[model samples]
Target: MGLRVQVDNLMEHHSQKSLFAVVLGEMQDGGLPHIGCRCPRCVSGRVGYAACLAIVDVRGAETAVYLLDATPDIKYQLNPLAEWLGPHPQRPNRFNPPTAVFLTHAHMGHIGGLPQLGPEAMAVDGLPVYASAELVALLQETRLWSPMVQGLALRLFSPNQPIPLAPDLTLTPIPVPHRDELGTGTFAFLINGPGKSLLYLPDIDSWQAWDAAHSVLQTVDVALVDGSFYSLAELNGRPPVAHPLISDTLAFFAGWPGELVFTHFNHTNPALEPNSGAVATIQQVGAKLAHPGMRFLLD
Candidate 1:
């Protein structure tokens, strides 16, 4: 089905007891309209937020929302969840913060929006934020971010261990090979819900670098893997990019059982254009390009 139809179906069942994962943004870390470039996509005023996802559980008396990454576009990203977040206790015309946020790594697009939760903005109190031990230490040691870090209840999570969010929902962090400069490892979250499971792996150096890549992909119902670049030609003579090229990714997962969805696209990626040959190739292979508001039902 088309993405619009899928979104409508999810919204229609919002009141029912269900668990779903929604894409908040699907662009690469820099996001669309990249910093200084005047590329055709950027010059045309096309916009896309950084890669991020939110898991919503409506199975309990109160809905619970959890974020996969706190991107720079978080303010706009959170707008869609306003109805579920409800009103803020003391602030008018505002919504409550998410129940928690899970960080994949320390990239700017992954943890950049944290400043919005500090004293100057949302001023959230005791918000639960989960991340790797090294990442947590890095945030706490950064003097400039002390104000924001103070409000967060930073929790450390181990790789491959399941952290239960509800009786039927659990999130497991699986270490993946990625460019890590701070000695803080990267992760690809494996979310297990009541009826289905999903793997949110927005960034990875290459599928070959991870030993369990194929096995892990086979275990999930849906795999939102990295698609940062369609080809190295988009790099414009820069050094080789770390992410797996879309072409290689397609060949890597050909005939895999689980649904393969590509995301985290760079501004230069031709796949962003609906009619581009890259997109058509992906469609021909039964894979899909993820977009904002794309919903994957887990239960």
Candidate 2:
């Protein structure tokens, strides 16, 4: 399906007095049609934005929208939330910024859109951006990002501590192993709503590396996890990639009770092709591939 169609579908179902999670983008940081690459998926005009998620809470007088990550494709990703976000107070045709944004780590795709919130673009004032203390300090200390950081009220969140968004809605950050070049910790957010809980974990090094993987997965009703590469073949004989293979992920969650869903697909991932064997294997194991517009009701 086309991107517009997917986005329209996402905007179609917005129930009041409810909370839900929506898939804003399902591709890796580079996104589809990766820069300067002539791969089949890239050349075929197939498009996908970097991995991102949005949480919408409509249990009050006004709807509140929170984003899990501010990807490079954030502008397009936020378009579907226009109705919930409402119109900007001063801007004629623009929508207001999200209620807040939580960062998983300091990766390019995770924090790149921050510049868009600076004086150059949205110019949002005092936006609450939550992240690890180290990550927030990194952004504040970097001279190049000072302009954008200055406008944001960056808050530090500790691992495993829950931040309540509403009466029964809380978000807890759980540390995970990943490629950390800047000494900033990576986190997977577990969002607990009234009726259900969902874990947003788009990037991780591997399941085995994290001792709490099984325990954490068992706690949530659904998990949106890293599926960056299907196999080492996608690496073209290079060393193993940071993310765990889809096959291994399926095996790890074979008989789990909770829903297992995959996202953050790399351009070379064969699972991106609807008819690929990789996709078939995922389905056969009762797992799911996340697509734009996919929704999980939290309450």
Total backbone clashes of candidate 2, pairs 3 or more residues apart or in separate chains: 0
* Cα deviation of 44, candidate 1, in Å: 0.9
lDDT of 1 by residue, 220-253 (tens): 9999999999998998899998899999999999
Q: lDDT per residue, candidate 2, 123-142, as tens digits?
A: 88999999999999999999
Number of colliding residue pairs in each model: 0, 0
What C-alpha lDDT values do all the predictions have? 0.90, 0.91
| Candidate 2 Cα errors over 4 Å, as ranges | none
**Cα TM-score per model:** 0.96, 0.97
Error of 1 at 164 (Å): 0.2
The collision pairs in model 1 are: none
